[model samples]
Target: VAEWYALVAAPGAMEAREPLRDLRGALRAMLARVRGGRRDRVGLGRAEPTLRWLRSLSAFTEGEPGEGREPFELPRFWDALDQTFKVTSQEATKLSLAFSRPPLTSAEDCRKLSEDVQNAILAVATVYYWLPKGQGTTLRKMVRDATTEVVKGMIQLTETILSAPLESLSQEQLISTGGVWEACEQVSNLPRDNQAAVASALAACLGVVKDALEEMEHALVEGQDPYSDIVEDEELGFRGNRDTYWSEADRKLLSSCMGLMKASKACLKKVLAVVKAYGKADSPEQIAQLDDLADIANEISPSVDELALSMYPPMNQLAVRLNAAKLASVLKKVLEITKTSHVCPPSEEGWVQFLTGAVDHNMNKIKNFTQGQL
Candidate 1:
């Protein structure tokens, strides 16, 4: 297509329009033939077999015990799998992007990339057979499901290159290629077991709380908005000649809120440590309890964010008071749930009590700040 357009646009091409038309038709037909040509030596276009073979391997080893190879530890195995997926996904994207840019990748080079892509995904599938059979059915199933997503994405991306145009990367090709990276990303979040799931949920919550804490900290401590360094929250709607400002009263209120945010952060961090040390999911009831615990912990970050944001310029004392009440309730509830949950044992009860007392103290301090006391 590119060659035909170049030839037609050349000067005096109108004098040779018939030959130009012929060239265009021939080029179009040639493109079709090339697209429909015999499958490459590596089975690039005829990829159903490769995908089916990988899926069958997953099914075959779904129940089989590991015997031939020294099985990798689940965490190590998972991490290795993630790295492989990322590298393979990057390679596949690189090929597509190379063709999209100038000096397009050659057919031979594309074949080589496709072969590498296929081999990488095959390696991922084959590892399951070598995985330890002692893995719990749930964890195993989760692993296989995530693995299947990656394999499915890999096959889709590889197959897309077969029909890709030589001129530029098409939208369909971009989506197909992106599917692999998206699936690879999910692998990072894949939990090893239910215990890890609970911890992940809390860890994610802690991450959000930390972000809010940092943004407020940056604004208060460094006097710079982390998100928009030059723009003040007060000037968001109406720009002004006045410089960005945060009054001392607002600072003190934000400071007190930060105190509560810090308390929430510490409480979650300590609870997460306990969860890692004592959390159990051996039984059905225990598993359900952990899930409930995770859900409760997930509530802290958003409340922390809401209360913290209310402390921005022209601070709404009413909104601050309301959000503070909500955060205090959430923290107390999380602490209460952690106290009776499987993650919290009788031995850790004293530690939890101390943690609860710390939360109460911070909550009271914030309460006083919002109420205009020292």
Candidate 2:
């Protein structure tokens, strides 16, 4: 009967409470029979005490009869027991399903599944810790180990996703995709002792990517004057060589560059406005605005670099010297814009270096052209 009761109360059993009550009743009857037996019998004498203990607990299964137990109270106890079983079954099912799934295919999928897995882990841990000491030890260990593995996998997958190139993702994707920030938030929901290492690692990863993105955005939107050395070279060359002259072509190029600079500055202002709007909002509309900001920033980035290159003394010495202070001022504003934008790199460092180098090469070309003219 005890074996039967254990099987009927197993986690997957249906109608657990009904069979459990029946088992208790059968035990109660058997105990009564054993108690009525001859106490002098050799085998029955020692077991009688154990039988009495089971009978005492049977009162819980079948409330004290004729003792004025409130009618409402019985139903409440049954309802609470049923609810506990239902919740336990649901959580168990979720944990089983989460661990049974195949490997994740994409970052988005990974992000979603990681949340599910983490939730399941928390559920299992909650129940395990509530169990009395020495009870469910094996199951608790299994749950703890599973939680550790799932958390580790989640952290790794998040890093890989965040490490993807930002330029390749649309603004909508960037806003929706899970990465360091999302990972940190999810990890923070876990038990405190489990959170520290993962949270710290994720925070560090976010910091590095954020700094890199700021640097890249600064370069793209405002342009870095890589040809400062070229400016010094020109100043020395023209010091006593010849009067600096501006030809019609030179004047037209300078004007075009300045016009481009003015337009870029205007675009940056609009982009900043969009970014401000994005930051202030937490709705879907604001997310869509972020896409717009990204698009505008991308479109204006090249133009900004071209304008800066044109002003580099190596490329157009007269243009650089003519608007030296303004050029410096524009570059400074670009850095400020990038600093405030809060967008970070989607991937690694190679692309950032390439973009910066490409702008430098253009300035070098201008330097080569000026040398040829001389």
Candidate 3:
């Protein structure tokens, strides 16, 4: 049995070896108890058969017993394993009951319970691994159902931690990021198809939330705006202006641009909620809502971009007239709009370059006009 385990653990094993490792460890522990004379003769007799079956199973190992023997068939091997160690509906039901209970109090107790839960999940997954293509036997269905329930339980626990306020979360919970996603990844390795979809949803949900948290930290803690330096340069140019003359149309245009940016920010806030809910969306209706939300987000970006671009020509004309104060006011408004919009730029430097380019062009035009006048 140990040799069989060694072969399974060795490099280039054709199949997943996790369950085999667990099974081997359990068998070794059982053997130790038997050697200690803790189990009765009947227990030893039952274990002997299983041990002999495992020994026979070891023959499927790569280059085992002889050099030119027939290659091991993976399906046949899994089928034999399933027949030897059946996972009955009763076992799955008992596990389901245990998993449904509230979490334990102590850390040690929780760790032990977690191990048992993992073992139960692995047992169900083993049975799932051997199921014939498109075949839905009662026992196989029971195992799959149990696996789903257990996975859902794991997701709920992980989300409970993730959804909580960060300051209120325990150190352990904070450190255990991606727990649900990792569990889903393990389940995705099973032969079942829906496991992949579940894994994808969990991953997307976690990714969106993590990104939002990072963005929030950047905005709040860092007190840094990626567009700050560019806006400051434009502000300096505006401050250097000698004229204070203003027009009603200029005021209206500035007001309209600021209003459009504020509206875009509101739309972005709504899109964020949709993004957060997308992972938890189960039904077709909820999925359709996410699609609609995505469409709204896509629509808002271009509209806001158009509004930002519209201010450029007018601000440029003002700059040419040496109306530095109005130009400065428009640039300041642009900075305020960009900061409030929370729209990430296409690149690391963001839209600052685009905004500053317009200002630079106006400055060059003013410089040329003065030179021509002289």
Local distance difference test values of all predictions, in order = 0.64, 0.36, 0.37
Error of 1 at 234 (Å): 24
lDDT of 2 by residue, 1-374 (tens): 95675464443332212222222232233323223322233233235443453344344333322133333232343344334334433433332233232331334433344334334333333332332212222222333443343333333433333333221333433332333224323322332211122222223333443443344345434533334234334546532212233343444344444543543444344334433433422333433333333433443444444445554333456455334334334434443444344332333223334433433343444444344344
| Colliding residue pairs in candidate 1 | none
Best by TM-score: 1
Q: 1-374, model 1: which lDDT tens digit per residue?
A: 87786464433333222222222232222222222322223322334544453454444354454544564466677767777777767876775675565454554555465556555655665554455434444345456676677756655654455445543678978998788788878877778777776777778788888888888888777664334434555746633422464555656666667777887888789888987999876776677677767777878988988887777766776688788778878888888888888777788888678767876776676677667532
Off by over 4 Å in 1: 1-189, 224-244, 369-374
TM-score, one value per model: 0.54, 0.22, 0.22
Number of the candidate with higher lDDT, 1 or 3: 1
- List model 3 lDDT by residue over 1-374, tens digit each: 95775464443321222222333333333333222323233233235543543343234322312124444343564454343223222232332333233331233433344345344434433334444322222223333443454444343443343333222344444333234334333432443222222333324433543454344334333432334334335647532222232233443434433443443343344334323433233344433433333333334444444434434422443333343324433443433333333222333123444444544554454444334433
- Residue 152 error, candidate 1, Å: 9.7
Backbone clashes for every candidate come to: 0, 2, 0
